[model samples]
Target: MTMLEGVTTRPGGRRPGATRTRVDILAAAQRSFAEHGYVLTTIRGVARAAGVDPALVLQFFGSKDGLFDAALRDDPPVRALVTLAGEGDPSDLGPRLAARYLELWEDPHTGPRMLAVVRAATAAPSASAMVTAFMTDEVMLPLARAIGADQAELRAALTGAYLFGVASARYVLGVAPLAALDREAAVTYVAPVVQHHLTGDLTPP
Candidate 1:
């Protein structure tokens, strides 16, 4: 089965209109946050987009913040990343991690959610905290400790910084050349840096 298959599902066989309305509001909120950004997107705007009352948006999500959190909460990439760290050979972790990271972003099913978090995090403190906490607790530290790296936390932090820089430049900023490169080519260029961070000695040679 596809890695992103279980992240979300179609609202099977048409349930109650209230249930469907909640789903519609959530979908609209995601699109609004992705397109207009968190600050500019409002509950009223989402309600208008979803063809529901602003009160209905609050009825389902409590607040705009709550809706935003719900929209981004089902991140499949994190699960995939943890699994990759656990299942792969230590020596190949850097390259494999880089490849998988790009794969998740490039995929249609997962890419928007990835971008939404990355983009929204820049403009919203709460989003930034959520991303940072996830990276530290769920990804970087775990991977570093799993591989028995020295200064594991530092290595993890640097790794996250490096990966996020690449992602931001290529995917978010639309930087020339980097953004234009194919996924494999980008991985080849960046993987060694990741490998060095993952396994190479950090001390001066």
Candidate 2:
């Protein structure tokens, strides 16, 4: 018998609750990735947490990498960061962006997911690409364009690289002194560099 045999089916012979099932799977994946990080989070574990078959998780997300991308994409912080990059004074963009980025990492609701994404990116090429695209396309590029900056793309790249480095060192690698710094202190240290990237001259001196 086929997998659908003896099972309730919807129109077009599709399984019932397709939307809800996908949502459930994604929610479970988010939790698992947040708690366990990427290397430790398994498709089977997420499927079991969501109360769905392992095949169903694969059918929905295709693989662990896809699930990680979806979970990161679905996260609210991604959109929030994009929005934040364009808000506030252009002059104060550095401190503003740094504060918000650090706040997301410090927040209980968002930190683990951000941590998961960073950790995954280090281990997976696909995850790394997703992060690069998100930081460039979603956040920095638009912000640079909004400021009418010359070499907008380069400026955006510099800004994203700096922020990503700071985040990885503090949150992911737990680098000494940096990781030990409290949020405001971290922001204070980071804001000037971010400001320079956003508004300072890029020409080699």
Candidate 3:
């Protein structure tokens, strides 16, 4: 059901090669956003990448933002996050989770895709609620259960807050201290904070 990178085809591409064409366009779109960021990316760039006509990108996603959303889930990032929340080791959940988050940003292809979504969602008040609700229900609920903790929802929110702060400083604002740290080092520091929220005993007063 999920399309490739930034490309999705409407299924009914029953005609000989319509499906393949749609996919190429989407993949191309993903590449453009990742390399150039949202501001610099264009439909033509994607088309060139995919070796397709520009109209195809528009035909598939309808707009650049639609394509942007599709690109973030190249290999089911959300599903992976949710699954990890349920099954990963409780003691190391925070660091593992942080590492996964960092991996997404480090991908270069998926990073810009996420940045575009975050920026757009932040700018729109309506989308903010939707994004928040999705992260909590899908990610936090399961994460809380994995840690065998009560008040899963609150814990999930706390985890999300921690993630948001780190991501904003390291990626969006490019804060020197935060951005300078490599992924492993960042995870080492971030994991404990996340563990505390998830386990409720990772830190002392």
Whole-model Cα lDDT of every candidate shown, in order: 0.79, 0.81, 0.69
Task: List, residue by residue over 79-176, the lDDT tens digit for candidate 2.
Answer: 67656655777788888889999999889778877887788788778889987887788778988888777888999999989888899999888999
Candidate 1 yields a Cα-based lDDT of: 0.79
> Model 3, range 25-118, lDDT digits (tens) per residue?
6667655654565566677777766766667678887776666555544453544666676565677777778888888877855676667556
Candidate 3 overall lDDT versus native: 0.69
Candidate RMSDs in Å, in order, are 6.0, 6.4, 6.2
Candidate 1 ranges with C-alpha deviation above 4 Å: 1-28, 47-63
Candidate 2 has its poorest 10 consecutive residues by lDDT at 2-11
Question: By TM-score, how accurate is candidate 3?
Answer: 0.65
Worst lDDT run of 10 residues, candidate 3, spans: 1-10
Residue 114 displacement (Å), model 1: 1.6
RMSD of 2: 6.4
lDDT rank, highest first?
2, 1, 3
Clashes of each: 0, 0, 1
